[model samples]
Target chain A: MSNEETAGSKPSEKVIELRLPSRLGYERVAMDAASSLARRMGFEGDRIAALKTAVSEAVTNAIEHGNQHNETMKVVVLLTVRDDELIVSVTDQGSKSIDEAYVSRVPNISEAMQKDDKGGWGIWLIRELMDEVEFTKAPGGGNQVRMVIHLER
Target chain B: MTTTRQHIIEISFPSEFGYEVIAREAIATFARCVGFDRDRIDDLKTAVSEACINAIEHGNKKVHGLTIDIVGVYDGNMLQIDIADQGIQQYQVAGAPATIEEKIAGKAPARGMGLLLMTQLADEAHFLPDTNGTRGNRFRLIWRERVETLEPEH
Candidate 1:
């Protein structure tokens, strides 16, 4: 969202916030919310699908790793709809801090296939699907991932 | 976020028109995961949309900075939704709603249709007490599961 917009220039920016318990199936709420907003903004079918996938991976990561399956912890998903882009930020109330080195490393397919658990592709998938992605610590002490997808007019 | 088996979700959005669709979509997906059939999900969406509209138009008076809060919980046999709004104008605890013929004959305005729809679509829809240390008007909607589903208990 921009800091300044002339009055009566465009649709007012909106924000939808969803706070879900740190559970697996609850992530669908975030995904569906984002998909609805993106579709309303005229995002294409493929982009909406991509947005849902990216949102699912992000929320699933928040539940599985960030919150470590502790149902007491909550995963907060903020969807900000601007005139030109949709910004989604997923924050988890986790005690674990995110490692910077691990965030940027690209996983090799061969290496991942050799391991029993072929996971760890979430961050990479989000990075690939979203137009812009950033990971930072929440101001209130949690891990947050903010992803932005541009609306092609 | 309690330790009990109930699955609860809390959502809040700016008090504006058109955002209710997003809330409807979110809850529809939740209802599906909680084992509601297609017809029931559609009814839930309509009920949620009407309630959110009432929250925005009446409870918050369409104030831009104000927000509407929705909390949804699904226990084993019941799905309950609580839609709360900042009490700009207290909801009138009045008598029964107007009849359809009264509105058709221009005897009553069509303003009460939203509430009527809410009560009809949801199994139970009623307003919570506006007092007792609470700052807003809270409306609650409950839908009970008629037949047990195979979905695992939360």
Candidate 2:
């Protein structure tokens, strides 16, 4: 009953795929699903919290920016659990391409406070929290953010 | 519940013995956000896990390589979940047993003993035939937005 099957990747990776509507609160589904996998993989409490926040930010970005809040568009979340790390990939059906200039920008607290919209910190926060982060165009021509967190004993 | 627009979450995974843990957690969280009480969510979780596992075990005779697809929709007033799998066919249990779609025809009272929890927990559940060129047995469970309801007798 415990036979491990590969999830369309490497022999050791197990995947859980979720296709979510491009909506705001739907990100919670990604957060809970990733955290559940992280907890089972023996991640500490704080690590689990970080994973949730990273997931939330990535999915929200996909919904608001990539899909442009289109209800018909889908935000696809892939939770891949490996022996050493957990990799989360959030991709959207891009109605708009993500601006490459803002991918790695660091936001200043005061400067963001002055802006009318207090957003734009999500991409920065994801980089700071995760062990490895990368942004690339997904196979479906959408924006995809891949974030990985090491499972430490 | 005051918010407008519909919410949909679709999940797919390989048909295997495990993985029910992840699916159930996702479903429960979605249910909670849609305003179901804690008790209803718990019941929902159980039914979800069992129904998925049963699908895997009953379909194809070989669960390896098959896939389970679930689509959940919340429209502020009700939640409808469609669970479908790509199996060769459904294997029946002993006795004058029936499948889920059979319940609609009044051919059976329940979807065998395996799906008893789903029948009990959901306000309405039925097995529907494949449409849109999709394959496999599909089961739908419907629950209206939270309201005062009586508890079942033990």
Candidate 3:
């Protein structure tokens, strides 16, 4: 089966889309969906929470980093069910690139999580939670992020 | 014969504070059972709260009459918690997933970092959808034993 196809009948595949606003209000729904889906897929309790948090942080970064917290620009998240795995892709219509140097330098989470260090950490948090991650340019002038977390064996 | 230890909590709310409260309570209960230290409890609470907040704010989109289902399992040294939410159409967003590493390393823009943090905090992580011949959505959280500590002096 292809990457997008879920492990069921052709029509069984499901997808969800949401608009991530700058305010925290819009992000909640996606987070909830992520948590529930994680749990149902047989992820242990702690891991489920982590995946949800990861989705939140990524969407936030898409808003903060990609969109620069701009209200007009919409932050988009696509949650798809593939065979044996859940694929969640978030995209933002912004020109800014992710700060790879800042995220990679602080390999240790304790260091990246330092209270005083507020410059960049959201992206770091997202990387720590999910299993696979990818970054690509969107069709228009924007960025796309696809993160994959597998269902338990 | 041995009996399994199971704890369950069901929460439903339309505001951010509700998510925070339930997350804190769930973490506290889990920490106490696992003998987690104060610092460890704090970490668990923060991580759980972040997850809950994301659910309420992003997944459910602050919709009323919606509920988040949470379950905790204590398997000897291991502690597992499950949080589930029904799918709501209003909260769904659209776009392709981005590459997290490239963005973080300056090779590209940031993406998919939240999964990294949760995985870092917890020993394991996974993602699933409810499509059980039904129309709603469900997710989960899985982790190993929490860091334990001695009780503080009065």
Instruction: List candidate 2 segments past 4 Å from native.
Output: A1-7, A113-116, B1-5, B60-62, B92-112, B130-135, B146-154
Task: Sum up the clashes in candidate 1.
Answer: 0
lDDT digits (tens) for residues A35-90 of candidate 3: 75555456688877887888877777776778876665767776665557778888
> Which residue pairs clash in candidate 2?
none
Model 2, A23-80: lDDT tens digits are 6888999999999888888899999999999999999999888988887888999988
For residues B10-59, write the lDDT of model 2, one tens digit per residue. 89866776677788899998998878899889888888887787778776
Alpha-carbon lDDT of model 2: 0.82
- Model 2 scores a TM of 0.84
Question: What are the lDDT figures for the candidates, one per model?
Answer: 0.88, 0.82, 0.58
Ranking by lDDT: 1, 2, 3
Candidate 1 C-alpha lDDT tens digits along B26-135: 99988988889999999999999999999999998987767789999998799999999988988755665677899899998876898888888999998988666666
lDDT score at residue B154, model 2, on the 0-100 scale = 100
Tell me, by TM-score, which candidate is best.
1
Local error of candidate 2 at residue A69 (angstroms): 1.4
CA lDDT, candidate 3, residue A116: 73
lDDT of 3 by residue, B28-82 (tens): 5445645656765666666666556656655667564454554455555665655
What does TM-score give for chain A of every model?
A: 0.92, 0.94, 0.78
Residue range with the least summed lDDT across 10 consecutive positions in model 3 chain A: A1-10
Q: Runs in model 3 with CA error above 4 Å?
A: A1-12, A107-115, B1-154
Prediction 3 global C-alpha lDDT = 0.58
Leading candidate by DockQ: 1
